[model samples]
Target: MVDPDDVQFIDEMPHTATGKIQKTALRDMFADYAFPA
Candidate 1:
């Protein structure tokens, strides 16, 4: 099951110069996220 608390709603995803979603950059940005207990 998915946890709502763990979901992050961004205005828009990060993109590269070529206009492709930067998965690595996105992951790095949220790599330290901590879910509430």
Candidate 2:
């Protein structure tokens, strides 16, 4: 789970030509998820 308030919104998600998130994927990959407060 993640905190709704802490959830960061981005205008565009970085991805390769394959439609897979590239740069943004790393952020999510190593992100520390926590339950919503």
Put down candidate 2 lDDT per residue, 1-37, tens digits, no spaces. 8645666567777889998879778677648866467
Give the poorly placed runs of model 2, Cα more than 4 Å off.
1-5, 23-37
Clashes of each: 0, 0
Which candidate number has the best TM-score?
Answer: 1
lDDT of 1 by residue, 1-37 (tens): 9746667889889999999999999999889988779
Candidate 1, superposed: residue stretches over 4 Å from native: 1-5
The number of the candidate with the highest lDDT is 1
